[model samples]
Target: MASMVWTRYAAIGDSFTEGIGDLHPDGTPRGWADRAAEALSTRAEGFGYANLAVRGKLLDQILDVQLPAALALKPDLVSVSGGGNDLLRPGTDVDVLAARMDEGVARLRAAGADVVLFTGVDPAGSAVIRRTRGRVALFNELLRATAVRHGAHIVDQWSMDVLRDWRCWSIDRLHMSPEGHRRVALAMLESLGVQDAGDWREPELAPLPALSRGARLLFDARWARGYLAPWIGRRLRGRSSGDLVTAKRPGLSPVGK
Candidate 1:
């Protein structure tokens, strides 16, 4: 099995893997998994790809729901990334989350698929998610150790300074923008020893205009009304954004070619 050429690639996780912010013209999510699949297909003429990821899923939900399907696919490579949703909730224990995630990684490896794991990204657009930076760091440490123990490749998102830029995030302040997803796909391929399109890291842009205190407050209010409030409502009702959503790419098939 050459590191650069995988015949089949399966992705399992939550919104990030599902491609929330990067949407097609018809509104279908086309995320990093899709990009990686396209890149892999270029390396291998008939590459197959499946993405069993849904938006707003927790680490545990992904383990219970998506992992089984992924194992059944018997892909040569599997990308497993989750835990951010769990960490966002109040009083969530990241260590326990990490432990559960570690078990999932071990299971994937035991199933004989080369696994790729990811660390949570620090949010630059939201003060609320920004506050979780310390907790996210702790989880990333555990994730790194888990990858090492399970012989998995880690994407190391925590080490990427490009993610610190606010431009990388979508307006919802939770998911990455299309450009952000593109960069992540390139990074993932590079981590797997696969040559990608070009440099994932681009030159920095000029800083955004400084907002007055009143204008900043108004912007925060709009964000709360548009995104944060609805998210909280769903949490209170014990629902998820992915409640009935199915996998975007449910079966392995040729991509790019």
Candidate 2:
């Protein structure tokens, strides 16, 4: 009987890797990387995994922090999802993002990670909040080229889910919802030649509705509920809430008042 080769996997990237937008039942961010790790563990033989993703990270930051830390683990499979912050930041040129990605891939390869997976940038649809679609396309192209040069597998999520259907995005238009992340995780597994369990179901995302005043308000409120409310609650509880004085007069206070 032939023995199966089980590979240990490690994930490195930015907020997407850290599960920034999608929240777990416990209110923790359940990014696609964690989902991918879970899927791989359940299906792949002899798989060990580690997720080393931080929030608010750009390509340079990932190259500096995550690359070194993940390389230390010497994983057989490595997945990187970044560059969104780079695209959003000022003075972020294509060449810079490309260089950082190349360096990241080289370092991972040197660290004995035989299988590398790179996620492309998601589509920027008609959402008023997101950057121009052209920039996203450029980043995806650069990432694809870099991954191919390094012999790494490319997860064309930008094309697969985001562009294929605008519904794959959250109301904020920047991040993926839990359902979107699930689809992305499955795509990553498929790219890596890993099969999913029988229980995995594809999420049916609704179309992106036209932006209306009421819808915008509701969406903004939901965003606050998911992202900001927890942080505000934590700060309020830890500090002296009494010190935070409320304005007696509404119009005389800040804009929100």
Candidate 3:
């Protein structure tokens, strides 16, 4: 409602928080954070927003780099979503990572901000990512505990079954599509108890069509070649897509209509 809004909002995380798959007409990204900021602007005029998320960032990077900036802004609401990148790596102890994540949330909450946390989506749709589904589940469980311990709100994307549809995913099958980002923004608002007309839980227009045996094979090959191979190469070299990239909207600015 117009009467209730977070005057200052800061989002810190990885590609999910940075709005990777959601692209603007000018080749810029306008992820869920921006959508949520716009919604807040409509309700509370002059709502200021900052997004300090970059692609390929681990939870540590988020905490080390973005957390300080978010704290400096002293936002009324802070949304933090990360650790999906960490799950992709082998031998990653997510429980330990969850503990570190809890520290970040604790810091934000201690700064007197209402913090929001997110559980990662199940990546079972992808052959390469399916192996990490259990890890994702474990991280989600730990994240729930962290939220409870810190008195933070959660977006809970892991339980949103609508995200299981491939259409909600980008070509890389990692980041969310524009439609997915839109729904996430609605979900965030709903979690904050902000009433609006948007329906984030609406079903897809049509059921996904099953691919034929041959088509499935071809698709898998293409996916592996185009996205998976490059990603693996990056990991092998300890490189990241956000190696030199900085935050898209580093400073809090008034959201435009």
Candidate 4:
């Protein structure tokens, strides 16, 4: 870690950062952020890491709750991810969210931490999700500007063509599968200037088995009913999947400790 010196690193975000779709053997999420910490810890001795990300959290909750707690740890490096959950809600003003994000990130920068931000993925691979492509693009631009303004590092998920595959996503189509999380971890390490961390840009894996058009239609229908419908219902009811959940790694501790 000659080029890096962050001894205490903290992550703050939602399910994406929490690694919801990438479950460990014990069924706990072990996502890219955690993998990033492990990689950094290997390079730098006694590195500390904390993740305050919870599923179904909005940008507001991330900043309101998690951000302060992360700052309390006085982390030298922090990754801030949000707005994907906000994008799912109806009438979510991308501009307003970006503005709030700007403020929150500004605070992190003012705290003398090297901050990292992520742009949302290009959902062109998902037929149902591609409809929001324009909105995601606009939000990503604002995030780029915010990063430039605050001197924060930005991981460009939008440019990850490797992620635009069915194999990279979980069955629910909302979270990254194990393969996706692996490449994303590589991407984060690359952004941090970690040499020889592996090429995240490389596409790998066999193609999914072909299914008849009728079967595909039925699968989509089931997915919509089983996952999408309830998600929308939760939004309408003002409930969140994270209501009963708390941060998985709430405090900064030695990596893998």
Ranking by TM-score: 3, 4, 1, 2
The better-scoring model by TM-score among 1 and 3 is 3
**RMSD to native, candidate 4:** 1.6
lDDT-based ranking, best first? 4, 3, 1, 2
**Residue 34, model 1, lDDT:** 92
Quote the positional error of residue 226 for candidate 1 in Å: 0.8
lDDT of 1 by residue, 1-257 (tens): 45656898999999999999998777889989898888788778678999999999998889999999999998889999998988887688988999999999888899889999998876644667877877888999999999899889989887777876768778887889998898899889888887536667765556778989999899889988999999999999999999989998889988742
lDDT of each: 0.87, 0.63, 0.89, 0.90
Tens-digit per-residue lDDT, 1-257, candidate 3: 34356799999999898899998788888999989888887777668999999999999999999999999998999999989999988799988999999999999999999998989887777778989999999999999999999999998887888888888889888889998999999898888888863779885557878899899999999999999999999988989999998998888988742
List runs of model 1 lying over 4 Å from the truth.
Answer: 1-3
Best by TM-score: 3
Give per-model TM-scores. Answer: 0.94, 0.72, 0.96, 0.95
What is the per-residue lDDT of model 2 for residues 1-114, given as tens digits with 9 covering 90 to 100?
Answer: 322233566677766676666887777677676677676665555567666666655677667876776676667777777787667545678777777788888778777675
Tens digit per residue, CA lDDT, model 4, 187-222: 888888888878886756666788898998998999
| Best-matching candidate per lDDT | 4
Error of 1 at 34 (Å): 0.5
